[model samples]
Target: MTEAPPDRRRAGISILSKLLAMLLGVSLLSALVAGIVGYRNGTDSLRAAAIERMIEVRESRAREIEAYMDSLRHTIILDSRGIAAQAIPELHDAFRELDEEPVPASEQAAVRDYYEQTFVPELEGRQGGEADVGALLPTSDAAWHLQASYTAADPDWDVRLATNDAGDGSAWSAANAKYHDFFRETVEQKGYEDILLLDDEGNVVYSAYKGVDLGTNVLTGPHSGGALQDVFEQAERATSVDTMAISDLERYTPSEGRPTLFAASPVGSGGQASGVLVYQVPMDEIDGIMTSGGAWEKTGLGRTGETYLVGPDHLMRSVSRGLLEDPEEYRDQVVANGTPRETADRQVAVTGSVLLQPVESFAVDESLRGRSGTGVSTDYRGHETLGAWMPLDIPGLQWVLVAELDTSEAFEPVRDFTRNLLISVAVLVLLVSLASLLLAQVFVRPVRHLVSGVREVAAGNLDARVAATSRDEFGELAGAFNEMARSLRTKADLLDEQQGEYERLLHTLMPEAVARRYQDGEETIAESHSDVTVVYAEIVGLDDLTRDMSSDEELETVNLLVRGFDEAAERLGVEKVRTLRSGYLASCGLVVPRVDSARRSVEFVREMQRVVAAFDAQHDAALRLRAGLDTGTVTSGLVGRQNVVYDLWGDAVNLAFSLPRANDRPGVFVSAAVHDRLRDQYSFREAGTVESGTGGSSTGPEPVWELEEDSRG
Candidate 1:
């Protein structure tokens, strides 16, 4: 259809007015959008960088904490293995100042009655029961006049319990005089509060401080269920020298009513445990690490930013910043949290630690449950905070590091940035409107040329260019546009290359199907497959191969073996799942269904054995690969967020892992389930039953089979 021509009489004034309106309208809208977009992009980028730094700091502090913990344990073990523990009888000489004379006849009768009547009943005749000393154990000289605490109300309670201790020269007092310097050095040098050595029978043989239990037996005295008792029991339970018994922080009446921890190792040489070396862990080092780490304000963390640790018990491993910096404020908050007056009073007064304080923060709770993530949440102190938390990788510990900042402080910079951006946008918009009105009249020709160039560029013409016909700002604008187009072309090519690399990396991490599902924004990428076979393989004699190599060389050797396995899995229709330490896991029929997953898995195992054998031959090394295979229905998914991994979970995988370790020889081990399916084409021999070390044994030893596969075939 043809359009009508414009009337000349209605053209001039109307067109100019319309153009002025269009310029102002476009200028205002564009300015608003540009300002908002710029502010959002800058804020997000800055926040991401800040959070990344916070995580780095958290991890750094976590490493320090982990090291400190390891050292504390090592110190306890060193002491346990030292001469002090080896020469238990010689320690008797140090208490020579305490007279061996019998108690006075008048006091002796009362002391005997008190032992039988007062301190004895708290035990209920049970070996592990603890005695309650009513409030705290009193070791004062006057208190000992009754052989225990003597309150005005209980003045006569000890009348039947007159002291054997009043004659002077206390066992504790004299022992302190001889060994106080040594024990004090341990506390000061090693960052421990109190140190205790328990005898084979759980008696407090030696202690750093005399104010607490010194002669009490943990098995049947005031210290039952205490650190010494617990450490002794743990030392007894340990079947090997490599293991030590460690206790989490808890209040102990034996430690003068303060929070303490005990780590015990068996003492005495080459025989049964003689005693336990216990350390009352000090909080100073831990507190210093947590609070001192984030004090650098340059990271945008502001006043409310801090990092701390939480343990499996949902208690703080470090002191709360508020408690250390402002105890009065902390006291008020605990009181407000409905802590009873008496409890609150005792809790705040329990100095030297906030270790056992329960954490009510959702971030800490979530992290303790093994979820690593970042978000906004209400913290333990009831403040809304931005937080990132992750579990530490330290062995024998279930701890998570939490980095947090209060919302008000965290976003203060963002708010300021946005305000400045808005003001700049407003001024720019006004100036641009005025310029647009004037420029619209003079630049119709230049605008036509620019629009034509932009259209050509949009149509994929990299060679499109505008002529600088007039050497003015319009000409400069044209040159800038051309330069931007050139930069765009270069960036697009680089982006394509990067995208390809990422795709390759992603597929290497997970199956292509799983990766696609994950990239499609699926929160949980899980798939269950029936009749899949899992192979757990470990390289043997790795110690011999890398014994003389440096750390980097050893790692390279391991990586070489892993790469070989990945290549074999690729050829055999198996998916490589994960490599943990020396163990490598892979499976068949995971992403794709197959009628013969068991056969493929066995073949893959043989191929892996060949690769390791060849590596041994080529390097003049003695490396070998052993594997265990099991076929069953299995589930697979991503297990972690920060270090996300494609992992498999089920009985088949567990049984396979167990099988490899069960057989001492480097060869293929298969479950009867796998043997039954592959016996038609393979030979096997019975190994033994799978002992699920939790006591109950099933899957009879006869069902496990050793697969004899010849890779040459």
Candidate 2:
């Protein structure tokens, strides 16, 4: 006769199997969650870091450009001061000494002779010796003769005429007659290119050269419409000592391109405006400071990044990089009809503060207000750029000193870092995941074998044994399993009796269907029908009850309550699932059939009330049991591996939980879904809807009906 299968076999479970299952499940879940969270956090951190870095770059550029503008202002101021010192003394003396004196015909003839022979020879010889011979000569010799004739006509001609004959008889002229000669000679001899003496009303009194006419209003000169003339007028109106001014004259020269910096200082006599000592420096010269000392090439500053000058009227007066070769072209491309290239100009104007890499271009018209410095980044001339703008304090010109660095160049390092960081992160994730998977397989292989062996043993195969491969924990576990299997084989004859005891234990611990599911290694999903109902019972104030008790005592009381509820549910042919402390989740007509889910729910409630009353009668401490019931189709399944539990899900389960909280009367509260299913068989009080927490929607008021114990059939 074939030997009967072993009944118990110690349930054939090794500690290693439990430990491995727990570890794998927990590790996989933890790693997956951690990876997702880490990726999100890493991306957020990178984006924030990028923005902060860009802001810093913008701030640095703003400070740099501001310093550059200050340097340019100082250069212009120093030049003005130098020119004023040289011209002011002579101009004041000439104006102050003007007088009318009488002269005889003989003295006049002598003065005239002295001027032509001594003074004229000296002036001609001086002009010839000068490096710029053409600078001293007018286009027409007639202009020179007219000046000489004017000198000869003066009345006090002989008194101030300097003679080479040492007071001997020579032609002479008044001091006023020599003034024009002195003015022309001084201006040319001093290397004052393009000199013009202006009267108080801003009219050109005389010109060293004839191409530009004298007796013309300086304000209406060809090169006088722009900022240059404005600076001159401002200085003429000033009452201060030797006032100075600087401005940018746009379109000054049509061919040489771009604007020029017009720096001038007042030449005054005893508080009366005499003339302006003006100097014109091409705008490129001031902007050259950025490229000076070979910083641009040496510092890896790209050609796309350049420094430029912008007028207050939103016009690019001068630019470097030769990208936009002409000032007009640059202005046309960026500022069309006096509008800014980007919207950031509005912000810069409003804030009057620096915006670092604002991702937009700014307008000089708006951003040049009130001595503020700022930076912005935007598409300039169709190319991405990082630009900084600071107000240029040229005395009479409203302009901004602007510097731009191409974004691709400025953030190259950041781009490389981001690329490398992403590459590194990808590599790390790949390596980690690969290593983890390999390690898991290596670790789980032995455990799987041991589990399979134990399961075979539990299935009545006493011959099942584990292979002892290595000397680690797994090897030891395998050896222990083998030993236990051998011992089980020796007791094979007494297995029939042990099988009865094992069945009794299983039935005591769990319902028949659940025990069968565990035995068969089959997952069970408990389905609910119209005739099925779910009940959720919870013990109130359980947390407070356990606070004062020892851990073991707390556990014992919790287990007792859970066990009692489980027993009651099982007796009524309901599947009970244990939850957190003081709560038992169970469903009727899930495993067993019922006529009406509401009636079944009522019966379940009545039974629970009877059990609670009996227990209260026996014990001094009355245990308050609150039960909630709801009838609907619910999905129930076994969840977890080691500590497996049969759980119910869906809106039905949520409503069931809400019902108990809605109940004020001590017994059971049934949801509308439940009440409608069995309203004829069971009577209930209309409690209406009570706000309760469920369904992931905040605590909501749900319709609940109260069922008293007496109302149950």
Clashes of each: 2, 14
lDDT of prediction 2:
0.54
- Candidate 2: where is the Cα deviation over 4 Å? 1-217, 220-226, 253-258, 290-304, 320-377, 386-395, 401-422, 445-713
Q: Quick one: best lDDT, which candidate?
A: 1
Which residue window of length 10 is worst by lDDT in model 2?
A: 350-359
Model 1 misplacement above 4 A = 1-15, 92-101, 105-181, 293-301, 331-357, 393-397, 438-713
Error (Å) of candidate 1 at residue 67 is: 0.4
Candidate 2 root-mean-square deviation in Å:
28.2
Each candidate's root-mean-square deviation in Å?
Answer: 19.7, 28.2
Using TM-score as the measure, which candidate wins? 1
